[model samples]
Target: MKNSIAIRREDLNKKGEKRVAVIPELAKTIIEAGHNLRVQSQKHPETNENKRAFSDSAYADLGATITEDIAGARVVIGLKEVKTEYIAPNTTYLCFSHTHKAQIKNREMLRTFKDRKTTLIDYELMVNADKARVITAFTYFAGYAGMIDTLWTAGQRYALAGQLHPFAAIPQSIETEDLNIIKKLIQDIGTHISENGTPDDLPPFINVILGQGKTSTGAQEIYDILPVENITLAQIPEIYANGDRKKVYKCVLGITEMFRLKAAASLPAHTYAALTIPQKESHYFQHPSDFESNLQAILPYASILMNCILWAPQFPRLLSRTFTKAQWEQHQTLIAIGDITCDPEGSIEFSQETWIDDPVFIYNPATNTSTLSMEGQGIAVMAVTNLPCEFSADASTEFSANLSPYLPGIIAANYEASLENSQLPEAIQKAVILWNGEFTPRYAYMQDYL
Candidate 1:
């Protein structure tokens, strides 16, 4: 029998997630391949605009059946995880199921997939022969949006404190998707800063960025639009001591610079380099307890903290509550934390997953409470979970292009076949987190988490 596939609308509750797994252009490809293609009708959450990335009319025009009967299809595709109650039994569902690390929050959802005998394929795990990610993500936009949002939040906080500067003129990321518009705005801000210089009221400010990955690159792209000075991690202390009220300074730190072994004082420099040189791989730190946070030295000088590194429960936090409180009380220079990774209570312990509409919150380390406004005595946190959604059109187009190649194989695969005999491509096979409601061999480690 021919296979049937359905593309469901993202959960309405997930605001600003305008990305569609199968765009209308890809719908045509699936239909031409002789598979039954269906798309659920959906309206853009921003109803005032009345625009959707893939309108129902567009899918229908491409010869795809437009209907709400998603459960009728054998295979379901979506951009985000579907609610446990909405997942139908015995269906192949593909999405970014963030359960790879045994996330406590997603344990119930993973259990539901097992109980329903649903096949769960996680997009994040889709890898090529090199074990590198095959699925393109919105990481670039995450960094871009995060930096823009963080700068804007910092401006707001500064304005409330009666200090007006170039950042005050900056607009929100959601206001426009045109990179040129943002560039122009930042250019103007840069010009203003160069000519007028920062106000004497505020001290010399430095933006410390952690991680050198795509996310960090994206943040740097936005920051580079201004008249900024790049400083090395080793020079941070000297720059802070001398102070540069004329131009904004940025420092990017790698893993070796950001962390140290617990016994770094006694260990030889060569031994430390050997242990931390291969930083990207988990093998570097055999245990989380082996490392101590080295971020404190920079905290006293940082005006903005851009955390772009990936963090898991097994890893030590880059910024702890005690450290944050001490910095806020003593220096008062760290105005905002742009947590691009947005791992709730993961890396930046004080940061919580915030929404796009209300992107920032003031985390009061003293009370361990968060306030939506920046008026309180706390550090502003920009932790938008869906940062890339700000540029949904661009993100969806790139993601669809990357995901198209695997569609033909996925649509033709026989899910009933045993794991070893499955017709799915190796990339897809490796990505299957759950097969027939049980953890695949590659993902069996997740059983303990579930």
Candidate 2:
């Protein structure tokens, strides 16, 4: 039985990705379940100390082998996209490939997957029959850290503009020891805002959060702790007019509010309006081109924008570059944007890649130019590509628990057999983009990329 499973160390290309796929506790679980386990070491030629939350000896203490070369392992699991050179042929690999939307970056990697007869199981595509996500720990944590980092940048942006606010006191997520510490500091900030109201020099703080899924929920969990008022979209102008400086105004924009039917005016009276909420959502999703962005109504008043929408090309961009430049030309009130969706111009149209070390860049809507400087005129965009890795230990612990239940089936899956004769769980089978050298039917549409 080729029952050995290994964890791949993140490659050098992953600049700030400091997470391990398998932590010590999960290593023990895999070993206890009657499988040989190996984890890649972080050290150069096996250094005693590494950056992982757990020591390498911890895995060895749990009756697991620690080595650098996971390439020979029959089954390898990891986080993020595997480096092209590190991808081994004829092995079953599990990770987020980021190739689903036909990303040009991974086009060659997909070609490699086909040519090398690799069996790739993408963690991102592991959805049920109805498209409900099964593994979501990473997403929630990503939002959790994203919000914290958002505050960090928002505070800096304010300080640069010489504004007096409590947000300037908040620290980045990576600076904290853990999630609890981050919460404590934010709670203290909330208390401060409660005791002393925000400065009158600045306009009303109208914070907008896009999307209501786990990612948005996690961000709101942190945001709601602040002295804030949750407002409806219709009440935005009222809040801006007579809102309290002691409180931050929060608004969540879902798909229905983000987009409106472009053909609504052409339809008969109460035609699109008569449809149920679900019906409207389905109609927009099924025919995205029929809708146009309705986000401009809220943008001019928003102080901070936290974007967490699931964006694809078919759907309209949450903020088009053209719209952003035009909107800023009139009344630009946006201060900072926490683009947790981090698709680099996919959702927040001006969002470009920023790293953990230099985590923020100022995107100038006026000039359609960007600079890494925190000061000057532009919306400070905090688009850290790997937010979850800032809370790597916490994220990994939750991920280990979520992956626990599915481990047995994933380990026992028969990848040697043909896709038709395979014994993988139905959900897992559906996530397999490549099974035994051939692209799965569901992913056959990716053929055009090659």
Best by lDDT: 2
* lDDT (Cα, 0-100) at 360 in candidate 2: 91
Q: Write the per-residue lDDT of candidate 2 for residues 232-264, one digit (tens) a residue.
A: 999998898888888888999888888877855
Model 1 misplaced stretches (Cα beyond 4 Å): 44-52, 241-246, 264-270, 273-276, 279-284
Clashes by residue pair, model 1: none
**Model 1 C-alpha lDDT versus the unseen true structure:** 0.82
lDDT of 1 by residue, 15-92 (tens): 777777777887788899899988877663445332346578888988888776777688999877788888999999
Best by TM-score: 2
Error of 2 at 234 (Å): 0.8
Could you tell me which 10 consecutive residues in candidate 2 have the lowest summed lDDT? 42-51
Candidate 2 accuracy as TM-score? 0.96
Backbone clash pairs for candidate 2 read none
